[model samples]
Target: MKILVYNLKMNLDDTIYDLKKVTSKKIGVSERDFASFKIVKESIDARKKPHINIVYSVMVETDRKIRIPSKGDIRVLEDVLKKPFVYGSIKIRERPVVIGSGPAGLFASLILAQNGYKPLLLERGECVEKRTQIVNSFWAGGKLDEETNVQFGEGGAGTFSDGKLTTRINDKRSEMVLEEFYKSGAPEEILYKAKPHIGTDVLKKVVCNMRKRIIDLGGEVRFNAKVTDFLIKDGKIEGVKVNNYEEIHSQVVVLAIGHSARDTFEVLYNRGVKFVQKPFSIGVRIEHPQELINYAMYGDAAKHPRLGAADYQIFKKFSKRTVYSFCMCPGGVVVGAASEPETVLTNGMSEFARDRENANSALVVSVGPEDFENSHPLAGVEFQRRWERLAFQCGGRNYAAPVQRLGDFINGRVTRKLGSVKPSYTGKTEFSDLNYCLPPYVTDLLKKSIAFFDAKINGFGIEDAVLTGVETRTSSPVRILRDDNLEALDIRGLYPAGEGAGYAGGIVSAAVDGIRIAEKIMETYSNESL
Candidate 1:
C-alpha cells in the first residue's frame, strides 16, 4: 500500500482543484486503483491559520501483506483490520446504571446497549426538545424550570450549548466520537471541518435519535430521575436514592454526572467520597461580528462559500498563566444558562444553519486559590457562587445577564446604551461594568487580551461588541481520586468517571473515560472476568 498526504487550503476551489488533480494523475490506472483511493484520516496543524490535511494508503492487486502494522506512527489505512481500541463491544452481562444523560452517559450507554448490557439511564433534566422549551420559557417569561434548565437536563449543559465538538485533547478516540456523531445524524460536514459544531438546533435531533436507538436495544432512560444519594452497603455501592425519594438497586453504576451537578458533589463528599480541589477557568463570553473571525482566519477567503465562517482560538501566556477561548461559537447567540434562581450566568449557542445575530465565545482566564482563600474541595463552587451572586444583583435581581461593551470594559466604565449591535440573549441584559463580577486580576488581563484580539482580528474590540457576564462552569474544580482499577480511591465499587469527576474535559474525553471505566468494571468485577 502507498499512503499519500495532501495539504488542503481554506480557499474556494481548493478541494475541487485537488479532485481534478486526482482525476488527472490516475489516467492510466486500473479501476481497482481508482476504487482503492480513500481518505482514511484528516487533521489540522496545531498552529495559527492551520492547513487541512488528509492521509490515505493504497494497495495494489498483487500485494499479499495484509497483517496490521503497529509499534509506530503510520498511515490510517495500514491499520484497517486492527481491533478498535474504543467502542465496538465490551462482551459483558451485568447491566449497569448510568446517571445523567449527557454526552458521557449517552456514549457509554450507547456502547453498552450495543454490547447486550441494558443500561438504566437516569436523567435529572427533561429531553433536549422539551428542555429547550423550558429554557425558552425561562428566557421569555422569567419562569424557571429548576429541574430541567440548561445545566441539569437530558443532554447536560452541552445540549444547550453551541454543540461544539472541539477539544484540546489529541486522543485517537476523538475520531471515533466524530464518526459516531455523524452516524447518529449530525451533519457530515463535521467530519472534515477545521472547527466543527453540530449547533444547538441540530444537536437536539441527534440526541433524541440516539436515545431512540438505545431504547430499541433494551436500554431504559428515565427522565426527571435525579440521583439524590448513594446507597453504600458493606463499603461498596448498592444503588442510588433518586429525588431524595426512590431507591433503586444496581451493582455497577457509572457516574456520568455532568459538571453542573454541584449538589451531587456535596452529597457524595458527605457520603465518604474522597476529593481534592483543582484549578479551573472563569470569565465572560466575548461577542464580535462573525465576519471579523472569518477575515482573521481565512484572509481574503472570508467570502468563500465553502469556507463559511471561520473560528479562532487565541491563546496567550500571562505571567506564568495561560488564557484562551473555551467554547467558540460562530454565527451564534449568547444564551442565559443560569441554572440557579437569582444568579445570572451566560453561554453561547448556534444553529446548524448558523443563521444567528451575533458570534460569541468564552474569553476566560485561569482562576486559582490566589483568588479563592480556602483549599477545600468545594472552594471552586464558592468561587463560582461569589461571581454569580454579584451578577444576580447586577442583573436586576432576576436571571438577566450583566452585559458590557468591550470599549467600556477596557476603559473601566459602564456602558449606558446599546449601539449598532443588539445582544442575542433572550433574557434581559443591563449595560453595566463587569468588574464587580470578575476579579481585578482577571479584568486587567482581559483588557490586554481584548487589545491582542483586536490586533489579530480587525474590529474585534468594537464598542458595540457585547460581553456577557461570568461563564464560570468551564470544567470540574475538584478531582475525585480513582486508582488504576477505575474505582474511587480505596472505595470498593464506586466509579467516579467523566467530566464531573475531573478526569475529562469535553465529550470525546468524557466518552473515552466512560469506556475505560466500563472496561475496568468488566475486567475486574464481572462474574467471570475473562
Candidate 2:
C-alpha cells in the first residue's frame, strides 16, 4: 500500500541525508517498513519568520500497516493512471501549421509531432541562439531587429524573462508541461519546488532542446517566417502567407502568436476573424535594492543561504482601479522589451543564480475596454501605443526609457538625478517625470499603491527606488473568439491558443492551453492520414 504523508516539517539547518529514514520516523515506523518514498510536494513555511521550516508531502510505499495520524494530513495514496489519448478517424490532407514558436506553439507542435503528425512550426524571430545575440546587441546600443527582438523569438517574450513557471491554474497538463521542460534541460528542482522558475540563462538551453526534440520527431521549424496573411476559403483557414510572399497550405492552423504580435492581430481582424477587446494592465518597472527586499521578506533570517532570494507579490484595490505588482523578479534587472521601432517598454529578468544587486517588478493598474478610447476590438492596442509613443518622446525619441525616483514621482516632480537604487535597465535611461506618459488614473493609483505596498513590505516606497517607464505589454489586448471545440468562432480549422488568443496568462497556463489545443486538434484529425 502506498501511503501519502503531509505536513512533514524540518528545520532549514537539518540535513536530509536519507528520505526513507526520515519518512519512517515521521510516520512512526521502522526504516525497513517502507519500500520507497518520493517527495510529492515541497514548500517553505516562513510565516513564522526566523523560525522558517521546510514542509514536505511524501508518498511512501509500505507493505506493513502503519498508524495514520488524525490531523488529516495523511491519507491513502490513490494512484490513478491517465488513459492514453485516442486519435480521431478524420483524415488530414496537409501537415498542421503552428504559428509562433513560443510555449504555446512549441507544446502544441510537440504534442502533434509525438503523435506522428509532422507540424510546421513558424516563428517570426530567430532561434534562441541568434535571438540572444540580437537582443544583447540591441541592449548594447546596436539597432533593434524589429522582427526578432525580445518579444518575437523562439521562446516568445518569456525567453528574456525570469522564466517563472508558477501559475494560478490547477490542471494535470501543467505537470506535463513541467515534465517536458525537465526533459529539455531544466533543473530537477523545478519539478517539485513550490514556486519554480527557470532563469533566462537556463531557459534558453531548455527552449533550444525542446525545439530540437520537435524536429527530431518529424516536425519542421522555420525561423524568420512571419505569417503576413491568412489564406482563407469560405471562412475556413486554407493556408497562411509567409512574409507576404510564400503561401504554405494547411487546413489546420494553431494561431499561437504571442501577446506582442500587434501587426498579426490587426491582420487577423482585417481578415474577419472574430475578436473582442480584453482587459490588460499597464505600468512601470519599479526597482529597489535586493538587500532591502530580502530584509523585508525574510526579516531577521535574510542571510539564510537556504532562502536564495526573496520574491514578493502585492496588490491593492481602489475605487476605480486595482493596482498590483506583476512579474516580480528577485535580484533581477529591468530590461528594454521593445518590439516596435521608436517605442520603449520595460520588463524584468533574472539569471539562474539571481545574484544581482537589485530586484524589480511591474507595478501596474488594471485597464479594460471601458478605459479604452473606443469600443473597437483593437482599441487597447492603440491605447498602449499612445503611451508607448509618449514615453518615447519623453525619453528624447532615442529608445531610452524614462525613469524617475520614487520620491520625485510621488511628489509630482521630474527626477533630475538618480538616488540610492540605480536603474538596471539593459538599455539607456533618461530621468523624466512618469506623469508625462502614463494616464492620470494610472499614475494616481500607482502613487497610492506604493504607500500601501510599503506598509506590506517595508522600504518598498524608498525614496531611492527607481521607476522605469512604460510597461504596456502585460497581456493580450484582444481575445480571438473561439468555439467549444477550441476553433476560431465562425472559422473552422483555425485554433486560437495561448496568450495572444487571450485564453491564458503566464508561461505554464499558456503551455497548458497549447497542449489542450493540440489535444483538440488530435481528436479532430487523424495522425495516420499524414
Candidate 3:
C-alpha cells in the first residue's frame, strides 16, 4: 500500500533531507524504514512577506496502511481514479480526425494513436519551426501572416503566451497532462509546483517534442490545412474539406480549434452547428516595471534569487461588470495576437528566466451575452471585431496597438507621449487614447478598477504605467453546443472539444477536455470495426 501525506511544511532554506527526516518522524517510522518518498505537490507560502515557507504533499510507498494523526498538519491524500475507457461495438470505418494542433487536438490524437486508433491531426498554421520564424518576422516589423500568427499556430495561442499550466478545475487528468508535458521536455518542477508555468521559450520546444512523439506513435499531423467546410450526411459527419479543396473522410471529428479561429467559427455556424453566445472578457494590456511588482509581492526580499519574478491577481465588481486581471505575466512583454488582418490585439508572454524589463497582464472586464448588440450566437464575434478594428485605426491603421499612460487614461485625456515606462509591445505601439477602442462602460470600469488595484498593490496605477489597446480574445465568443456524449447536439460525430468550442480555458484544462473526449470516443467505439 502507498501512504499519501499532506501539509508537510518546511522553511524556505530547508533541503530535501530535512523534509525526509520530518516526514519519517511524523509518520512514526525510523529514517531507515521510511526509505524514500516523492513530492506529489509543493507550494510557497509567501503570504507572510519576509517569512516565507515551502509546503509539500508527498506520497511514500509502503506495505502497511498508515493511520491519520488526530492532530497536526497531515492527512491521508485521496486517490483520484480516472474513468475507465470501455471499448464499444460501434464501427469506426476510418481514422479519427482532429482539427487544430492545440493542447486538445494533440492530446486527443495522442491518446487515440496510442490505443491503436491512428488519428489525423490538422493545423491551420505552419509547424512550430516555421510558425516561430513567421511570428518573429511580424514582431520585427515585417508583414503579418494572417493565417500563421501568434493566435493560429502549432502550439495554439498559448505558444506565444506565458504557457501557464495552472487551471481552476480539479480534474484528475490535469496530472496526466502535466506528466505528459514533463515527458515532452517541460521542466520536472511543473509536476509538483503550485502555479507551474513552462514559459513561452520552453513551451515551444515541449510542443514540438509532443508533436514528434505523436508521429512516432503512428498519428499523422498536417500543417496549413485549414478546415473550410464540413461534409455532413443526414446529421452525421462524413469528412472535412481542408484549405477549400482537399476533403479527408473520417467517422469521428474533434473540433479543437483555438479561440481566435473567427473564420472557422463562421464556417461552422453557417453549416448549422448549434452555438450559443458565451460571456468573455475584453480590456487592455497593462504594464509596469517588473521590479515594482517584485517589490510589492516580496517587499525587501524581492531580490532573492530563489523567489524569481513576482506575479499578482486582482478582481473587483462594479455596478454591472466585474473587472479582473487575466494571464498575469511577470517579467514579460505584451505581444500582438491578431489572427485577422487590419486588426490589433495584445497578449502577454514571458521566457523561462522571466528577466524582462516589464510585467504585464490583461486587466479586463467581463462582458456577457446581454452586452452584445443582438442575441445571435455570432454577435459576440462581431462585437469583438468592432473594437479590434477601432484599435487598428487608433494605432495608425497598422498592426501597431494604441497605448496610453494609466494616469492619462484615468484622467480622460489622450496620451500625447510616453513617460518613464515605455511600452513593451512586440509590434509597433504609439501614444494615443484607448477610449477610441473599448466601450465607454468598459473604459469607466477599468479606470475605477486600476485605482482599486493600486490600493492592493502600490505603483500599479503609476502615472507612466502603460495600457495597450484591445485584448478581446480572452475566450471563445460562442460555445459550439455539445451533449452529454461530448458530441455536437445536432451533429453525431462532431465533438466540440476545447477553448474555441468554449469547453476549456487554458492549456491544462484543454488537454484534460481532450483526454475526456478521447476516452469517450474510445468508450463508444473499438478498432475491430475497422
In angstroms, the error of model 2 at 401 is 0.7
Q: For candidate 2, what is the lDDT?
A: 0.92
State candidate 2's TM-score: 0.98
lDDT of 1 by residue, 1-530 (tens): 44332443222344644643453243333344443444433444323443422322223231323333353332323545766534323333446789988888888888777665678899998887788888888989658777889888877778877788877787777787788789889988677655678888888888898899899988999998999999987777888999888988877788889887889899999988988888789899988778767776666656656556566778777885667888888888888888777788888888877766577889989987666778788888889888888988887787778898888888878889877677888788887789888888888888888778778777887888888898898998888988878888766767887899998887668877776666666565443322
Q: Which pairs, if any, clash in model 2? A: none
TM-score of every prediction relative to native: 0.89, 0.98, 0.97
When 1 and 2 are scored with TM-score, the better candidate is 2
**Model 2 Cα shift for residue 386 (angstroms):** 0.7
- In candidate 1, how many clashes are counted? 0
| Clashing residue pairs for model 3 | none
- How far residue 292's Cα lies from its native spot in candidate 3, in Å, is 1.0
lDDT of each: 0.76, 0.92, 0.90
lDDT of 2 by residue, 1-530 (tens): 88888788877876655555677777777776768877778888888887888888888887888777667777877789988878888899999999998899999999999989999999999999999999999999899798999999899999999999998999989999999999999998888888999999999999999999999999999999999999988978999999999999999999999998999999999999999999999999999999998888888888989888899999999887889999999999999998998888989999988999999999999999999999999999999999999999988889999999999999999998887989999998898999989999999889878878999999998999999999999999999999999999999999999999999999999999999999999998897867
Q: What is the C-alpha RMSD of each candidate to the true structure, in Å?
A: 4.2, 1.2, 1.7
Better lDDT candidate (1, 2): 2
Single out the weakest 10-residue window by summed lDDT for candidate 3: 27-36
The true-versus-predicted C-alpha distance at residue 432 of model 3, in Å, is 0.4
Question: lDDT tens string, model 3, 380-443?
Answer: 9999999999999989987888999998998878898788898999888877889879999899
Q: Kindly indicate the candidate among 1 and 3 with the higher lDDT.
A: 3
